[model samples]
Target: MVEEAPYRRIAAEIRERIARGDLAPGDRIPSTREITRDWGVAMATATKVINALREAGLVETRSGAGSVVIDRSSPQVEVVIQPDVPAHAGGFHVAASPRLRRAGEPELNRDRVVSSAVAIADAEGLSMLTMRRVAADLGVATMSLYRHVPSKEELILAMIDAVFGENPLPEEPPADWRARLETAARQMWQSFAAHPWAAEPLSLTRPQLLPNVLPYSEWSLGTLRELGFGVDEMMHIHLSLFGHVRASALNLDAELRAREDTGVTNDEWADQHGDELEAVLSAAAERFSALRYVAERGFDYDIAAVFESGLRLLLDGVAVALARREVSGDEQVDLSVV
Candidate 1:
């Protein structure tokens, strides 16, 4: 129902080119930035154009390859003209390599729509995700995506199911409980790192019921249940483990975006801000004991080192929890409950 004025402009331009053989299906088109520079438009406007082409089934965003036209011979190509791209966009990456569905296929469904949405989020950010934006990416009517999902929230939840489902954890875990949990954490971390945008929609305390996510929960709970804990206790422990991953993963997306925007690491940014930090420290050192202590320590720690240390500390806590479970009458838990 929503109308996209800017996306319409993008669709219109690309349609003209395709019809003229200036660009063909399977041909890689310029990236959003390239398109923006070529067309002399703002970055936001450029992003819309590419997304629109994607929705129309004319283009697809591929890592290392950029955006490519979906296919050369497809059924829907003749029917779809310049579809409008509604203003605004958004979403996170699902997988490093996406399975290209095809160009101009009538068999489009929810999975394809959500898949494209995930691709956009992977390439861009969650703030840019919208039904209109997603449709623009698919090169379809904005209304077309509505046939499968009702709202962005529903789409996001389904995306989590679809994306997370693609990488299922082991039904059988390793012998060491810590090692098994570490494996689980690493997998989750890789998922976040690959699709940094995945974390933006997730809430730590109020996670939605997802089959893929639930399995991890089942594994965690089963691990605890064998450790002489009741079902409720197991649930609590399961939450704690899940909380660790989600909370840490939450920062992954923002950190990556900050990197892209500034093209600097956190320490680099801090080094650039060193003078400012020095001034603030000088001013507040007298009032704050913590500031005086660090100043007296006379050390500037690398942020990357700090991040790694923090990660170690987090895992250390898990190790401690496991150790406590061992000392207690708690029996060994079977973590692999797939």
Candidate 2:
């Protein structure tokens, strides 16, 4: 007779309680923190216990709420996929996938914690992301999260690293310096677009030293160095490119908030209030000629296009500086003019 695993045994106990109706549906279940205290088990074991219960279709995570018993009578229940556990093995029939981890549901770890935080920040703005919110998203105890991440600041740092790590820099970048710089800038832009909340935290003035981001810096700076640019020039150019992306990305969160609050996109919102805007512009046409001129023609705003155009202009300026440096024999090229 082999001994059952501690996690399985604890899971069985909870399962029995649920079956007996002692832990009724819609009632909050013991969090991982509670389970560890009650069962005298490790936090990982506690997570496994919850994983088992969740896999059995006995509980579901509610946003802004912790795990609760699932109502058997209800037609739908949120399902959390466990990587090791085969899907639809014993749980209720899942009609659709929830906006939760499924493709690769690895065990709870720092990476998982960071990924969850990223997801939350991506869906909702960073302002709305909290420890409790991430815990609820993971269907684990908020305290258990601390075992993996010491603090929210640490978790955020980890999140920044994780986002940057998604797209690896090429080992052999494009031979052309301009092409290399453009490649790096566009990659950074894509990352910010994916997780709009990430841009602000990745500061320009007081930059967070992220391991994954170091390669990008090396690639960008190395490209400049190969082109004979001085260290000062390299840093300035790199920052200029980085800052451009960050500046555009900074608006992403605010734009997202407006869309969510107003339930319309920028263009839609403008159209909805177009008459009022036109009336104001019409009244102040002489003073606001430029505004009225563009307003009359209508501006189609696309952040991606704006970012690309800005990147091109910045690189063009860099090219001019390089040209000046070549002619001046390594002397510092003045960048005050175009």
Candidate 3:
């Protein structure tokens, strides 16, 4: 009698959950870490379990969302599992347990390893990510992961590429350059919002040259080129837009960490400090007239609203600067006037 592999056993249990409808369609499936924690398996084993479920059409990976139970009612193709036969007859019989995988299973691949890593970084911040941690989630031995990903840095780069690949570029961008730029900026902002940790790795000065990230630059530069902007100007515009989004997203990780450590949200923290803030503002009202006025009027401090407003203002200023340069035929327009 051949005992089932650890991964197969874990896969069988998840399959049973899906079959029982305990994991409804579109519901997030357990991640590698969650599986490891629950089943007391290594990361490699957890990865294999997810792979098995994927091969069996029980779950699918969602960018920044982790693995989700698929709608089994609409399976692309029906898979029929053969019954187990006796070992003496050169075939194994189906065991009484429902959770066993068939005789042969697919080997682990780089794609699965990267996707699992991305899921972990997305759920927790990048700080929580580690090679051993990722392996533990997958239920595989720590050493087994080295075969797929050489290092944590390489894994992070792969994760970035995977995230950028999630949203496909439009076949036809909006006709107007301003509209197109706005659309691109908003999309970038939304991506940062979804994966807060992503903003930290992306740098304006030291930009990464990943496959998915390059297209965004090409798209933005191409749009500006159509508007008669020089290459230098186009590149500046692209960097500015990306930098703005990244800057706004910088606080997301810190805020999330603060909440986790203190069990207090941003609003709660602000509320707790409100009395101290009021006393300080009142004491310095004469010197800080503007700050005091704004404080008295009250502010909602919504990050999304602020991001959109700043983006719109930035684009509007850029449009004005472009117009000035066009009318004056000046190669250098004083952008500060806008």
Best by lDDT: 2
lDDT of 3: 0.71
Q: Write the per-residue lDDT of candidate 2 for residues 109-196, one digit (tens) a residue.
A: 8877887688657654576557876775676667999999999998888988898898877778876777899889988888888777
TM-score per candidate, chains pooled: 0.67, 0.68, 0.68
Clashing pairs in 2: none
For model 3, residues 1-338, the per-residue Cα lDDT tens digits are 99878887777777777778899998988777677777888866776676566545466555566778766555343433323422111011233212222234345678878876887787656865777656544545568888988988888988888887877577799877777888888777777777778889887888889998787788889877766678788888888887888888877666765665455888888889989988998888898889878777878877788888889988987797688776888665443322
Q: Ten-residue segment with the worst summed lDDT in candidate 3?
A: 85-94
Cα RMSD (angstroms) for every candidate in the order listed: 8.3, 12.5, 8.6
Worst 10 residues of 2 by lDDT: 89-98
Where model 1 places Cα greater than 4 Å from the true spot, the runs are 1-59, 63-106, 230-233, 285-338
Best-to-worst order by TM-score is 3, 2, 1
Clashes of 3: 21
State the weakest 10-residue window (summed lDDT) of model 1. 89-98
